[model samples]
Target: MKQRPWINVIATEPEEIINTIDKCPSGAIRYSIPEGSKIKENVSNGVGNINFENTNLSVVKIKVNANGPLLIEGPTIIIDFEGKPLKEGSKMALCRCGLSGNRHFCDGAHSKQSWKPDQIDK
Candidate 1:
């Protein structure tokens, strides 16, 4: 039988894996540090509340990826056409080519298209 695909990260530095997992736009990747480890956990408080009010995360920035989706940074809440909340996250990749099977969120569908940033007409 064919084994299912998986990720087995082997690194000398814990921060290397942590930093990469932290950049996952869809939150599909996660990590848990073992007890007594030196690496500090970057998580919310025990009650599951993120203290954004005291932090300098007031600014939201959107970066247009080259021939890809729009990368959103900072705290955000994605809403639908009727103002209904869809998803919330610190980072997100929104579909720009409208070919994403996941709709608002990018699933790397733009890579399969022939669209280019320099092209004036679709």
Candidate 2:
């Protein structure tokens, strides 16, 4: 298995890799087929089968977790207070509770604090 800063994936057959990538909940893994590759066309990229080649504008989607962080998916750039890019990626979990030790990012601290979406003091 190859370990990246974000996730670990086992390098294997193309079909198997695509299958694994499809299971990723964060949408962190993406694959592109080469022009002449033999991969089948029916394989799903797990992102609504978006045809990136035919699109001019990248679509970004954000999902607010029930009682947790905000899930960001698609091409994104996260900037810090100084307006400098802190990170760039296809998926990210941003802290909404302000209790994360890793500011701007979630570290599951909200769970520890029993945070709720309707809580008065976030």
Give the number of the best model, judged by TM-score.
1
* Predicted structure 2: lDDT: 0.67
Superposed by TM-score, candidate 1 places the C-alpha of residue 63 at a distance from the truth, in angstroms, of: 0.8
CA lDDT scores, all candidates in order: 0.64, 0.67
Off by over 4 Å in 1: 1-6, 9-15, 25-39, 42-54, 117-122
Q: Candidate 1: global Cα-lDDT?
A: 0.64
Total residue pair clashes for candidate 1: 0
Candidate 2 matches the true fold with a TM-score of 0.56
lDDT of 2 by residue, 20-108 (tens): 66665544456666677787777744442333331433787898876778888777889888999998766668888888788888776
**Model 2 poorest ten-residue lDDT run:** 48-57
TM-score of 1: 0.65
